[model samples]
Target: MEYRVLGKTGLRVSSIGMGGIPLQRVSEEEAERIVNLALDQGINFFDSARGYTDSEAKFGLVFRHRRNEAIIATKSMERTREGILQEVEDSLKALQVDYIDLYQLHNVKSLAILEQVLGPEGALRGLQEAKAQGKIRYIGITGHVAEVLEKAITLGEFETVQFPFNAVELGPTEKIIPLAQAHDVGMIVMKPVAGGAIPDKNLALRFLMDYPVASIIPGMDSEDQVLENAAIGRHFVPLNEEETKRLQESIKELGNTFCRRCEYCMPCPQGINIPMVFLLDGYWQRYGLKDWAQERYLAMKVLADECIECGTCASRCPYGLEIPRLIAQVHRRLGRN
Candidate 1:
C-alpha cells in the first residue's frame, strides 16, 4: 500500500488506514481476521477511541501479537489532566501495548472545550505528562468543527488533527486543510466514505488521496472492505475527468441534509439510536430500499418515535442539524404508525 509521512510526526503510515468504529459490530474472531488482513495488506495505521465500547480491546487482541507492525492511535473524551491520565493507562491496558503511538483529545468541537483542554489542568497537560513518561509518542485532536480544529491547531500543542472530510462534507477544505498544511500538523481524515452514504467508495477515497492528508481511515469490519480500500491505496490512481464528473454528480445528489453518522449526537435521553435511524432512513429514501430499511427500523428497540424532542442530541451535534425534526421525519417514514 502507499505510505505517507504523518505530517510533523514523521511516522510513515499507509494512505488507507483502518477505522475502529465498525469493529464493534463484529465478533472477536471476525475483528481479529479483519485487522490481520489489513496489516497483511500493508495497512499500518489503526485508530480507536475509548468511547467505542470494546473497540480498543478488539484491536489489542491483534496488536499484542504483532505490535511492531502497526501504528496504534486512540483518543479519549476526558478533558481534565487526571481523567486523561487514567484514560491513557486504560488505553494501554486495553491495547496490550506499553506505549501508544498517538493519543488524541476526542471531539474538541468547541472553543470553550478547547480552552479548557489547553488550560492548566486540562487534558493537554495529561497528554504532555504521558509523552514525558513514555505512555504516548505524540498528541493529537479530533473533532467535527473546522473552526474549532483550526483554532486548536494554531496553539502548536497537537501534532495531528482528525475530522470528517468526504466528498459530501467539504467544510474542512475551506480552512482546516490550508491552516493544517501551514502548521505542518498531520491531517488524519475520518468518514472518508461519508459514513457509507457515498455509494462509490473507490471514487470517494481516491478523491481524498488528491489532498495532502497523512491517512484516510475508512471504518471496515469485513475482509472485502479491507481488500477494496487497500487496493485503492496500492494502485494510487487519481480520478480521471469523467470519474471526477461522476463524483460531482454524486455529491450534488447527496446534498447536505444527510447525516454523516459521526455519532456526536448520541445518547438520546429517550434511548433512541439516532444515527441508525438516519442511516436506515437514508437507505429507504436515497437507496430505495424501503422494505429493507423498514424491517430494521421495526427491529429497533428504541424507535425514532420514542424521541421526546429533548434536543440534547441536537445540542451536541457538530453540524447543528435539527435532530429532533429529523428523527420525527424518520418515524413518519419508518414507524408503524
Candidate 2:
C-alpha cells in the first residue's frame, strides 16, 4: 500500500487507512481476522473512537501483538481537561497499547465546542498533557463542518484534520483543503465512499487520491473490503475522464441533506437506530433496491417511526440534519405502519 507523511505528526501512514466504525458490527474473531488481513496487505493506519462500542478492544485484540506494525489512532468526545485526561487513559487501556499514535478531539462541530476544547481547561490541555506524558504521540481533529474544522486547524494546535470529503461533500475543497495544506496539517479524508452510498467504491476511492490528503479511511469489516481498499492504494490511479463523469453524475443524484452515516446522532432516549434507518431509506429511494431495502427495514427491531421527535439527535448531528423530520419521511416509506 502507498504511504504518506501525516502532516506535522511525522507519522507515515497508509494512504488507505482502516476506519474503525464497521468493526463495531463484527465479532471479535471476525475483527481480528479483518485487521490481520489488512496488515498482511500493508495497511498500517487504524483509526477508532471511544464511542464506537468495543471497537477499540476489537482493534486491541490484534494490535496488542502487532503493535509495532500498526499505527493506532483514536478519539474522544470529552471537551474538558479532566474528562479528556480520563478518556486518554481509557483509550490506552482499551487499545492495549502503551502509547497512541494519534488522539483526536472527536467532531468539534461548532464554534462553542472549538472554543471549549481550546480554552484553558479544555480537552486540548489534556491532549497536550497526554503528549507530554507519552500517552499519545500527536493530536488531530475531525468534523463534518468545514468552517469549524478550518478554524480549529488555523490555531495550529492540531497536527492533523479529518473531515468528510467525498465527491458529493465538496465543501472542504473550498477552504479546509487549502488551509490544511498551508498550515502543513495532515488532511485525513473520511466518508470517501459517502458512507457506502457510492456504488462504484473503486472509482470513489481513486477520486479521493487526486486530492492533497494524506490518507483516506473507508470503513471496512470484511476481508473482501480490506483487499479491495488496499489494492486501491497499492496500484493508485486517478479517475479517468469517463470515470470522473460517472462519479459526478452519482454525486448529483445524492444532493445535499443526505446523511453521511457518521452515527453521532445515536442512543436516542427512545432507542432509535437513526443512521441505519437512513441507510435503508437510501437503498430504497436512491439505489433501486426497493424490495431489498424494505425487507431490511422491516427486520429492524427499532426504526425511524419510533423516533420521539425530541430533537436530541439533531443537536448532536454535525450536519445539522433535522433528525425527526427526516426520520418521519423515512418512516412513511419504510415503516410498516
Candidate 3:
C-alpha cells in the first residue's frame, strides 16, 4: 500500500488506514482476522478511541502478537491531566503495547473545551507528560468543527489534526486543510465515505486520494472491505472526469444537513437511535429501498416518533443538526400508523 509521512511526527503510514469503530460490532476472532488481513495488505495505521467500548482490546488481540507490523493510534475524551494520564495507561494495557504511536485529544468541539485542554492542568499537559515518559510518541487532536480545529492547530501544540472531510462535508477545505498544511500538522481525513452516506465508496475514496492529507481512514469490520480499501491505496489513481462528475452528482443528492453517523448524538435520553433512523431514511429517500428501510425502521425497539423533542441530542451533535426536527420528518415518512 502507499505510505505517506504523518506530518511532523515523521512516521510513514498507509494512505488507507483502518478505523476502529466498526470493530465493536464483530467478534474477537473476526476482529483479529480483519486487522491481520489489513496488516498483510500493508495497512499499518489503526485508529481507535477510549469510548468505543472494547474496540481497543479487539485491536489488541491482533496488535499484541504483531505489534511490529502496525502503527497504533487511539484517543480519549478525558479533559484533565490526571484523567488523560489514566486513559493512556488504560490504552496501553488494552492494546497490549508499551507505547502508543499517536494519542489524540478526542473531540475538542468548542473553544471552551479547547481552552480547558490547553490550560495548566488539562489533557494536553497529560499528553505532553505521556510523550516525555515514552507512553506516547506524538499528540494530535480530533473534532468536528473546522473553526475549532483551525484555531487549535495554530497553537502549534498538536502534531496532527483529524476531522470529517467528505464530498458533502467540505467545510474543512476552506480553512482547516490549508492551515494544517501551513503548520506542517498532518491531516487525517475521517468519514471518507461520510459514514456510508456516499454511495460510490470507491469514487469517494479516490476523490480524497487527490488531497495532501496524511491518510484517509474509513472504518472497516470485514475482510472484503479490508481488501477493497487496501487495493485502492496499492494502486492509487486520481478521479477521472466522468468519475468526478458521478461523485459530484452523488454529493448533490446528500445535502449538508444529512447525518454522517458520527454518533455524537448518541445515548438519547428517550432511547431513540438517531443515526440508525437517518441511515434507514437515507435508504428510503435516496435508494428507493422504501420497503427494506421501513421493515428495519419498524423493527427498531424505539422508533423515531418516540423522540421527546428534548433537544439533548441536538446540543451534543457537532454538526448542529436539528435532531428532533429531522427525526420527526423520519417518523412522518417511515413510521407506521
TM-score of each: 0.82, 0.81, 0.82
lDDT of 2 by residue, 148-251 (tens): 98898899899999998887667788999999999999989887887667879999999889888999999898999999999999999998899999988887
Question: Where does the lowest 10-residue lDDT sum fall in candidate 3?
Answer: 283-292
- Estimate, for each residue in 115-158, the C-alpha lDDT of model 1 and write its tens digit: 99999999999999999999999999999877789998898999
What are the clashing pairs of model 3? none
Candidate 3 local lDDT, residue 264? 78
Residue 7, model 3, lDDT:
90
Top candidate when judged by TM-score against the true structure: 1
Candidate 2 has a TM-score of: 0.81
Alpha carbon lDDT at 196, candidate 3: 79
What's the CA RMSD for each of the models?
A: 5.8, 6.4, 6.2
- Each prediction's number of clashing residue pairs: 0, 0, 0
Q: Which ten-residue region of model 2 has the weakest summed lDDT? A: 283-292
Question: What digit string (tens of lDDT, one per residue) describes model 3 on residues 1-337?
Answer: 8999999999999999998988877899999999999999999999999987899999999998999989999999999999999999999999999999999999897799999999999999999999999999999999986668989999999999999888877778888888999999998998888767899999989899888998999989799999999999999999999999999998777664788666778889889988889878976775455776888899999998888888989999887789899999899999977
Model 2 off-target regions past 4 Å?
A: 255-326, 331-337
